[model samples]
Target: MASAALGEELKCSICLYFYADPVTMRCCGHNFCRVCIDHVLNTQDLESRVYSCPGCSIKFQERPALQKNVTLGNMVEKFLSTHRDGAVISCTYCVDSPVPAVRSCLLCEASLCDKHLRVHSKSPEHVLNDPSTSLEKRKCSVHKEFLKYYCTKDAICICMSCRLDGKHRGHRVEILAKASENKKKKLRNVLEKLVTKREKTEVRVRSVEERRRKSQEKASGEAERVTALFIDIRRRLDDLEKRILREISRQEEKLSLSSSDVIQRLEIKKEELSRKMRHIEELCNMADPLTVLQDPDTGDLCDPEVERGDEDIEENGVGDQDLGQISRISHSLADIIRGVALYVQDPADTLLDVNTAGNNLLISDDLKTATWTETCQNHRQTAKRFLNYHQVMSRRGYISGRHYWDVEMSKLGVCRVGMCYPSIDREGDKSVIGDNTKSWCLFGGQGYDNQCSVKHNNNQIRLPHQISSNRVRICLDYEAGQLSFYELCDPIRHLHTFTATFTEPLHAALWVCGGSIKILGRSSYEEP
Candidate 1:
């Protein structure tokens, strides 16, 4: 009986259960469970500007100070030992040896073991709940009534008092299951939108990755071409100079042969005159002049052999005979050198091959010029024709000679004059003159930032400065394996040169799209 009285005194006024972690109000010294009073204070209307104690009916203009009541807490803990977490739920009626309770009777405010539950009435008044040691938690802490609904607007569960008398009285509410289902539907839409956004981000990332790859490729090619430009220029000039020197050597050799033969013949004539003179001296210096005349036949000795020889010598040799032939050689060599220089400075000997021309390329009557044509020509398609690219090759191919050609860029919209093997690709972007290993070129066009570029082996080099001259010159030394370029300015600037062993005969190529390139001239030099 004393235990029952102690239970009533320890119970919270709001939850109608044992005081749990009890706190007290300074205003009225109220002793209610912490959660029970907290919920009451939290749901109070600020607009009403009034606070009332649930247990004492004490009123306060502002919230009263709350402090932990250590003494009260100890008492509650000692009384609610059976309700502590981890304790076995047993029938309250079992005194000595309590059996585990399966059902809690809220109406009776007690837990019943299985054996007691089966005998108890199953009437609606019993109101059996899940076996829990704390029956007070099954109801509202403030109203002491069962929680039945979820406050949708506040997104919180509520009891009968909160639904009817609290701030959530007029708020949207639903059963717990229905509210959870509604929230899940909204969350699914958010998930779908996030998935769509992620997919779009992935696509953009791929696009950027592809661009990065292409950029790297372009940069690599550019670097290679620029390095090749400076290196090849020196090589080309050296090769051309050596070839010119070889030509000079050949001409001098030829001149030496003729001069040598004449000198040899003159020396033979002198030896014949010396033998005759020796014969006369032997006759004249002999104390045996009479013996000489008698022993060798006086008539033969007296015969005018010396006079005849002198006459022959005077008539046959050294008459304006420049045995040295130095003047003649010098003149010949000079002429040959001049001619070789011309071969590397002009292209009068180079002309276009109309058969290898693109259909849009208009060829001159003499096949010396090419211009872009609006209409396709009435010509048969062949492997040689530049069917796709706007370019043309020369009719002449060089194997072992020095050649030169010129192009005037004043009348051109785009220009690429260069040397290329006949086997160069004739169809793709790679076929564009100077863009592959088979070709080298001086490019002046609009597509490349309206600047200049040299292309070879699929690499490109942008020129540091724009071309100021309207004409450019190309020189190739096949024997020495070099190709060089020049700008036909007032002083004729050296542009660039490429050095390589020519594995096959090369043809002059011109890339003139929407413009024209005429073979102004061509010249060639080989061992004469």
Candidate 2:
């Protein structure tokens, strides 16, 4: 039961039966029995070689090649042939019972009665066939009327009367059989070219696919490297935070110890000074002033107390002076400690100046302000011509913008790509902007003359730490997914046109990143 259902599902929609010689339409992606589509089209007003599917209403610009589904068609044909004895089909003209056979005539648009069908068979001009062939024949306008003879002059099937007409006079024509044979030979030639074209297209598609795969792989690898770098930087930042906190704690502890020492010294000096001052006041207020007063002649009881009081007065004065000094020193130390605390607490105090001359330059001088006289002296004649050129910046990086300049070449063709050799000072290095270190190095050479030469040409003309610009060309090869630096032969080589295959496809926005060499025009690839 399952197998039977599967077979029914494969049947053509238009025929409402099992498929008979199926042909798939390229545009609509539908399959139908060949005879079914032919019959459907036969009923319509035919004009275009292309067709639209009846089921989906999809149009086909390129007519798909008709392929015969022999398995399905043979099965249907054999089934019908086997049941031929049991099936009943009456003659339309006679309205008679089951006629053993049914046939159609091409010349006459009518189904035949058995007696009348014999007349069609006997006529050499009339063509009789099954329904499918008969319908195809009716579609041929020229063969509508019974034409046993061929017009040799016009290469057409015609009645003997058309040949006798004066209209075909002096024309060289051949019978349709010979013309048909010539047409088949022409068709064979076209078929051979179509096969070749299809093979070429398939190869081109495969090549593009391979290049795309490689490009994706390279991008993935680059992303992974960048991710790892960010991870390392994050770890370092965490370590920096921990170190900063430890240093702050150490400074705080030192300030705490110094404050305690200063406070203890101030308290001790204050207490000692207070005790001596009391002793001096008590001695000065004594009842017997003469008795308290000290005498110089022979030590006696009358002057001993006076002498001790004078000694105490002197000690109190010295203590007061020492206390005053300690108070001043303590104040100075407190102020110093407070200033250090303020610096440690403020974030701005920790930041180094970012806008200094030695830092990365975020601003450039307004070159337009340079006087015309200065400009002419500073810029080379060739460089001045490209003064209008600008730079292109994208999320990825900066690229050299468009410019028009000429390089000595021998060809006259559409411009493809350009390479530039710009004068650069060896001191000017900007590669750190994109973490690309290789671009900063110049094509190094000896003394004044070598430096002068390199400054005039592109840096790609030499490797890092090299000493010559013997040959160099920076090429943008899209297919290779690479902006390659190459060495050119000396004496200024000619012959500009060239093509090469690449293992990968290129990324977009690459030309935007200014290279040591500038690309002048557009680039494209030929089909593989």
Candidate 3:
């Protein structure tokens, strides 16, 4: 009986025989013979492109890969080896020859072939089951009778004699079939729940896998970009170093030439003084006195009244002007280094959020530009839409790290560039950029000549000078809680900086009244 049950477990539903090269299905975890499953899958309706598991009837949109069940195959092989000859039970009645048994009678304690089964008693007590070698298991050891009843209290099978007179006497008992049916009903309920849990788990697993794949892709892209950026930085630095060295050498050469000219003039003056001294010595010797007197004393006798001043010689040597030029170059180098460091931060590629744009604003197809239209546009009504002001916020928000982006505006327009929390008012005057406490902005007035101002919480500070350029750069350091604005001119000038502790993620906010503003830089929607 044990071997028969084990055989049933190892058998394939398609072949109705022991598994050969057993394979397990991923969808239903059912095992089948590899050749049998492949043949069945191949015969499925190709037009429909749907296949099902023969064991569980679970359908699949596409054919699933078959995983070889090595453990099951090994179990089958072991079973076959152990039961090589005993696989088919022989009839006890056919003692003269080995005849395969069709059924075994528990009441007779013997297996019967077709010929013997016909002569066997046909009674309820003579229970016949599939041919099994272990018939002793069907009888109760204590009562020596077939187990026909199940003790509910003890949860065991027993014979009629045990139920009536043995230790199980008077215990609540049921027919073996009824007990098995009740247990199966409970197990089916459990199986349904397990199937539901498995489905939900599969969904979660797929979601996690997708996130992992995206993370790897994003990391790879970032690494490549960073590598290229550093390479370019190194090249620029190397070029700058070489240029500075050349400038230093050129300055040194110019100074050296100036000093050389001064040295040559001094050498000529020294030779003339030596000749005057020689003439003076000859006069002292008396024979040349009359000749010296006759030679006519020129200005050379009085040391030639030093023509150039001490200042002239000093000027020919290294001076403050030369050092000052080199100092300025060094400062410029420092500025370039600082600018490159800032540039290394990820660009805030902000796209205007269409859902947040006011009805009077027209958003560009690329979502980078916003124009103030004279006529109202029919925009979808949403809670985030600005009903009172012609304003819009960026689709992306930042909670940490540094970001910078440029905004190019028409010189004739009045526009406000700023940062605002997502919870800023959407339908009132407070919704206007820089009008509420939740936002801060640099407001450019109607003309290029008009000075700009920084505003927040309805308070404004007018800048001393007009914004000289149409391009503005906005920088944010979320961790430091600093938001700064700069006029992108020949030399970028700082317009204003607001310092405050940020309590929520901030979006780049914009308000345009007369012309348009176009955002510039790569717009990344990734969250930090």
Candidate 4:
């Protein structure tokens, strides 16, 4: 009975089914599946600017704007998942007589019905997954066998034969089920972090949206408050021309000329916020465990696929938009909001390592801060450890797109803050940041004390002014080959910009020339 009511609420009035490619009309705030609305209004006649809602029949002379409702789409997906009447995972084993799958065995690589399961096997020796899954993916391609074990070294699944004598013979192997569970756990942590980020972003967007709404309301209130001004003007005009002018209409027309531009700009901003947060929210709500783990770029050494990216919204275009309106609205909105605006951003999740840290480097327990200690700690000798250089690479890395991070240092200390390639030498000349082709940094005046310098490929450009600040921020634009440095301040003062044609992935590099420095936690900055 409740489902039926939900079905009614979820359905589009035109097509009479739960919304698909759903869009909400601005006129009546009623949702209609995009196709249904298009068919109803006639796509050919969209330019006519005359349409009405099917539910409320509210007439709109301007063909009221449609906003894609991703949340509503997600709700529909969730509803369908529970119902399963529309799309069902049929038993793969039953070709001639297909039925809804009861159990999907990963070993046999097939979905089976209750009748098939009763006759197929005597005992359940295989792990099972949800019906809405392809069992064939669980088998090894080369061996044509069930992937029973996981090879940690190669980061691939292997069959029993491969585990015993094949390429993964000597590699550390764990049971497939156990390894999958571990991966799921890792995915859970990642999902939890992403959910927190999504929630925060949603809140920020909501705040800005509310602010925009209130701003529009306040503007409307201002028009309402100034009735006497319009009435006084109208009274004089009435006396001179003997014209009976509608005071409210006359005032709103003048006000709306400016307000329309502001409202349009705010709508565009709202859409941008929607576009940025939808992808994240979709990833966060993913139900497939394997898909969740595999979707994100984990910065694995062997195969460095930079798959996960939410850094920028390249999907939106500034083309064909009114430049004058944007410029005017920006100034107006800035004045209204007191110069505070939201920026699209991603927080760097870097953790310092005891093993990766040099013997002279002192790392904090939380791994957020690092310092140089005179006495070397008793640490194992590894190839990953730096020899002569006082440097550390961030655990998180960027293979593509833009990323920003800030480093806070002692006021009088010399330091290097930027990024380096993974192949940067751990020993010799190339080991030190800014001394080789693989590294780039904003050095604390290599030749002159207190002067700020930019370094890349063994070349240094010393700035004329001193960078007297405890906090320094670095912005990396990988594809564009622009590494920008800015002094962390109220206005974010630009210190220097380095241009380079980078060919590889980059990790956050911090080289303390002397004294101590700390990498601020995510809490310190605003993330969009």
Candidate 5:
């Protein structure tokens, strides 16, 4: 009942699918598949069995209630039982026999009933096979007999008569062993080769994708920054204009006030001068001429007042000459006003001539393409597999902690796989397999010591043994800002003879110089 109600939600949160070997977190009471939890923990570098819930921050130290839900399991079992049997068919052993039920023998040339089949196996004359169910059991195409043995030279199964014929004569033969086993070996070899090629191609795709993503992001960021800068520039320009405008306004106001004062003083002086000139005219026109011409008995005292008035008139005229300089100042103010008015315009209309367009800010095509090409080429050279290089594309940069040339053969044909970095010793050049050390830097692998190996174009690194058919992955370290090589290995999955070559990081040669980095190898889980 609970299973039905929570059916959809019960799916493991990690894989977002039906649970496979479910396990529960103790603290938070959350459940997840075993593989999913293990993968997360392993990749995250947790040493203890204790883990925190992904959905919640609760920590758990001990295993929790992790019993499988039998209700869900039963439903899957029932569904498979009903549909799977449709593929089975009648046994081939009973096709041509007279008996109601016939059983085939491993060696005997005849079919038998259940009773006879038991008796035949007990008899020393024939060998009996364990019965198994299959779909449309095969009968010999040439002889209409069940196949019992395989001919290695002909690479086919045959009946007793077919074995003696010229087509299979003298061929190495054995009991027709498990057909699935033979098929698996052939398929594994093909799958391995295909995977190697795919890995190479993927390297290119990954590099290009990463570069394009970053390039676009960087360009977008720069555009935003430029926009912000323009806003600041406009503000600064406005402030400068405002300061100059204020200064001009103040100067004009000062000139206006000074001009008014000069004009008022000139008018007052003109009125005073006009009054003096009128008095002089009246003296000339009147009978007072007798008094004007007569000097008193005391000549020293006569017309002393008139002398004083004349002297005052001379002083006022001199003041008028000094006041004339005000007109020159007014002319300077007019010039400034004309210049300020001409410069004041729209702020938006101003065009900044800053040059910012260039290709240096972008991720270059040549760098990305070269990195991808090198990665693909290395996979071909190291894995001893031919790949369609054109199919590959560059992807984002990758860093590998492990030196790859150390793939071990002992772990092949297994389910679990691992990758590790090799180590370097004081005698660095002597530790490598090849004599040249200029082209490569050996960081270190898990087991290698005191050996140097050289890698050149078209050179192949021989594996110690064969590898199983599995998904092959290759990684490179591109932090050096230039193309370099990395050796890749997974000791658990293969004993392959080849070392995978990986491309180094994308770089800006126009800005950054090429430099070498030491390679490091350990388990693929090691820090890159």
Candidate 6:
């Protein structure tokens, strides 16, 4: 009775069966199968934007999130395993009081208790097996006999009469027990192969999960770095803006003081001029010409040169010097931004490919350094091997996104650092880095010349100044179609940039003549 009650509680209200994947409704806390509830919710009126629980009829404002009922699911699994055959069989003769049976007879089609088993028929036709409620399933419907053998051709169970006189008379047949055992052996073989495949698939799943974790970590770190950089830029810009405004205010105050002094001088000069005019009127009122001539020259009293000088001061009150100071401060804002280093989070891990190395070029065992030697090494000639030029390509290539790597020159003598397509010519002069359209490079010359130039498709642009630093950085933005080189110094300086639509994935290429170059791993921008 307890098991029956537990089974009823574990059953889903919609499906009326044991819960396969039990879930509890957030609104009413009633358990139901996940699929049954999802189907009911999906069929509801979407315009209403509401769902109703099947068990409790509780209306929800929105579709509620389902909470898995793990404990209830486990209870259903255990109940099914313990009572797989349903209710126990009882003796047919025990009408007064039903008692559990020990064995069931196929011919009599009745279950027998221990008290009746001793008197039951022991004939071969009356097959007795473990107590079972399904007695008709163990008999042949047509012959009305117990199934004794399995017909191989028909792949069905048959009785003794059907095997000898029925339609399966000429077919091969085996004892039912032996035939069932053989089939189990074949199924076990298939199960073993399936287990092996599943194990391999699990290993791949773990690898993919690890990759996903690393990508998430990388994205988080990059986001933090970028946020900090932009915050600094905004702070600096705010400071510059305040400084410029303060400079303008200072110039305005100085100009106001100068203009005020000029206005005071003009007011005094006007009073004097008015008094002179009154004096001239009195002199003119004198009858004698001598009286007018005796008066001091009024023209001399109001000096024209002095008045012109005061006018010039008022007209030129605002000078270009004030604006020049503000302009200089405004230009410094660009300098501050340019001082910032390029922040690159994704750095390519590059290694020299031995198969693509030229005969004269000797690659380090670690595959990070490439040196030019006079003696040609006995390397097997392959299609990818560079036969004419002393060059070697990296093992990996990139087709998208930004990547940065650093190269340090032990001896800067005719060394080239650049990138090239994997399909670059291998046996001709074009195979050399920067000689064809498929390649781009920064070429450093040897000796006192120490000249530097960038070459692409046989066209070279010579840089004005020689590069003194031996360390250089290469940056590639594939989507933007930009590849730039920078000289790593006290303050990193940009050497040149090449802009072109990349047609194929690019590999790091190196060419050495009299010196050696080593890869110093990937480059990362450090906050200054």
Model 1: lDDT to the true structure: 0.73
Off by over 4 Å in 2: 1-103, 107-120, 133-144, 147-172, 270-528
Give the candidates in order of lDDT, highest first: 6, 3, 1, 4, 5, 2
Q: lDDT values of the candidates? A: 0.73, 0.40, 0.81, 0.69, 0.40, 0.82
List runs of model 3 lying over 4 Å from the truth: 1-88, 93-99, 151-154, 162-174, 269-310, 313-359, 362-369, 376-473, 478-507, 517-528
lDDT by residue (1-528, candidate 5, tens digit) is 333344445567788865665666554566777668656654333345465667675665543434445555554443233222323222345566333323445445444556666555576545444333321244467776666678777778787777787377777887766655787889999979986887687567657766876777777885676577446545644655665566666666766666676667667867866876676566567785576566343244346785676566455434322233444444334333221211211111111111110111122233221111122223213221112211111122135332221212111111111221122111233322222221222112222221222232314344433333222222223332222222222212211222444343311111111111111211122231
Over 4 Å off, model 1: 1-348, 446-450, 525-528
Off by over 4 Å in 4: 1-342, 345-348, 445-449, 521-528
lDDT of 6 by residue, 361-454 (tens): 8999999999989999979988899988889999989898777788987654688999999999998877888889999999885653767899
What's the TM for model 2?
0.38
**Candidate 3 has what TM-score?**
0.64
TM agreement with the true structure for every prediction: 0.34, 0.38, 0.64, 0.36, 0.31, 0.60
Q: At residue 62, what lDDT does model 3 achieve? A: 83
The model with the greatest TM-score is 3
Query: Which of 5 and 6 is the better model by TM-score?
Result: 6
Candidate 2 lDDT, 292-366, residue by residue in tens: 565233244246775676555444433212344344434433332221111111111111111211111111232
Compared with the true structure, what per-residue lDDT tens digits does model 1 show for residues 196-313?
8866885676577668666777678756754674355445456555655666666567657655765676688779757867876777788975677575533654468846865664
5 against 6, candidate with superior lDDT = 6
Residue 267 CA displacement from its true place in model 1, Å: 77
Off by over 4 Å in 6: 1-85, 228-351, 358-379, 382-390, 395-415, 420-440, 443-471, 475-483, 487-493, 498-507, 512-528
Residue 108's lDDT within candidate 3 is: 89
lDDT of 3: 0.81
Candidate number that wins on lDDT, 2 or 3:
3
Top candidate on lDDT is 6
